[model samples]
Target: MQIVILKDAAEVARYGADIFTTQLQRKAGAVLGLATGSTPVALYQELIRRNQAGEVSFKNATTFNLDEYLGLSGEHPQSYRYFMDQQLFDHVDIDKNNTHVPPGDAKNPITACQEYEAKIAAAGGIDIQLLGIGRNGHIGFNEPSSGLTSRTRVKTLTKATIDDNARFFAADEYQPHLSITMGIGTILDARKVVLLATGENKADAVKAMVEGPLTAACPASALQLHRDAVIVIDLAAASKLADIEFYQHIEAENQKLQAYLASL
Candidate 1:
């Protein structure tokens, strides 16, 4: 696990965008694992800007979203598919046909979950996966106690998660308490993973994920086992972490090492 603490949300987004920009530069046909929610919006917007500037292209890219609300069709305004369309996909050059979001309205969610995993396997797995941590330390809706080695499946959202997301729905809006999400094991299959968090609200969760024990109680902590997992956050989000100075020093040394190697 690599921790990168930046000045603020904007810097975090730009840093995350730089990773994606570099990935696309290296492999235009890269298979991407995507996420939704308020946290990743800025980074997605930055990617959109770069795409418009010809700095990166997703035309040959394929993407698989991490999760979707059960019972909501893709066309629903609140569906994750719609969220991706409005935030990243519509603005980028990615082919709609190459983008896959779990079938929220599938007749058989169990079979759909297996199919989702199969599609990912067929794409050679996700080259890079992007994530946003919930305040409760959940990743991709894998709330507390979700099996660390679980695969793609349906999960019932916890009350905390539902409350945190309630703002997205109107008072009378039908809010789904169920979701289809890629399990922690599935997310770990990606060659690289980038997780973004910002604001003071996420400070506790960020700390738990970065500094706490590697247990299922904190689902995002599973990233600790991944060979390449990057956690990017702002000062506000990183405030609760105990070893801030150590993390900063390490990042600085890594920057120097990377620069030296590039010049060699």
Candidate 2:
């Protein structure tokens, strides 16, 4: 696990974007696991800017989204698919057909989830999975108490998740009570994971994810078992971590070492 504490959200986005650009350059056909929510919006925007500037390209990339509302169609404005298109996909040169999101409105959700997992396997698994920590430490709709080794499946949303997402919907609109999400086991399979968190609201969750014991009660803590997991947060989000100073010192030394290695 690597923790990067940035001065603010914009700095965090730049750092995250640099990682993506490097990955795309190293392997144009990389399979990317994507996440939705306000936390990743700035990172996506930075990627878009890099693509526009000819600094990076996602043209050959394949993307699988983390989750989708169980009852929403891909065309729905609030759906994860639509969110991807509006936020990142449409701006990049990537082929629309290469992007995949769970078929939220599939007639047979069980079969659809199975197919989603199969598709990811066929694509050689996710090269890098992007994530955002929920206030309650949930990841990809895998709410508290979700099985730690679960796979791609349908999951019921917790009240906390519903309340957090409510801001995205109109007061008159109905929000789905369920979702299809890639589970903790599936996320752990990614070759690399990059989790982003911001704002004071996420401070406690960030602390728990990086410092607390691994437990299903805080689903994000499952990342502790991953071989390669990178966590990036702004000052506000990292404020609650008890080892914040030590993490900062390590980051600074790592930066120096990386620069030195590159110079050689």
Candidate 3:
């Protein structure tokens, strides 16, 4: 687990974009794992900018989104499909057919989950995975008590996640109670992973993910065991860390730390 305390969210976004650009340059047509949330909005914008500038090309790149709200059609405004099209897929040169989002409204969601995981494997797995932590430390809707080796499956949203995500819908009642998400095991299979967090609301969960014990209760803590995961956070989100200064010092010392480092 390596910690990067960026000065602000914009800087974090820039750094993330740089990572993707460099990776894509080194390995064209990379398979990417994407996360959708306010946390990644700026990063997506940065990538779009790079695409327009011809500094990067996602023409052949493949994307696999982390999760999607169950019971919502792809055309639904609040659906992950709609969100990705609006925020990223629409702006880039990525082949529309190369992008994959788990079927949110599949009648047999369990089969859909298995097929999603299989498709990722067939594409050679993800080269880099982007993640956003839920307020309760869930990743890809894999809430507490979720098995570490769980595969893609349907998940019931915790009340807290529902409340946090409610702002996207017309009303709380519009929020889907279930979601289809990649398992923690699936995420760990990526060659590299980047988890981003911002704002004071994320402070406690960020701290727990960074410094607390690796327990199922805080699913994000599983990153501690991953060999290739980087956590980029803004100052506010990192505020609760017991050794913020230490993290800052390390970042200052090595601006080019590898994507992963042993857990601190």
lDDT of 1 by residue, 69-156 (tens): 9999999999999999999999999999999999999999999999999999999999999999999999998999999999999999
Candidate with maximal TM-score: 1
What global local distance difference test value does model 2 have? 0.95
Clashing pairs in 1: none
TM-score of every candidate relative to the true structure: 0.99, 0.98, 0.95
Q: Rank the models by TM-score, top first.
A: 1, 2, 3
At residue 93, give the lDDT of candidate 2.
95
Put down candidate 3 lDDT per residue, 1-264, tens digits, no spaces.
879998899998998888889888988889999999899999999999999999999988999999999999899999999999999999999999999999998989999999999999999999999999998999989999888878899999899998888888885357799999999999989999999998899999998898999999999999999997899999999999999999888877675453435332
Off by over 4 Å in 1: none
Local error of candidate 1 at residue 240 (angstroms): 0.8
> Cα RMSD to native, each candidate?
0.6, 0.8, 3.4
Comparing 2 with 3 on TM-score, the higher-scoring candidate is 2
lDDT of each: 0.96, 0.95, 0.92
Candidate 3, superposed: residue stretches over 4 Å from native? 256-264
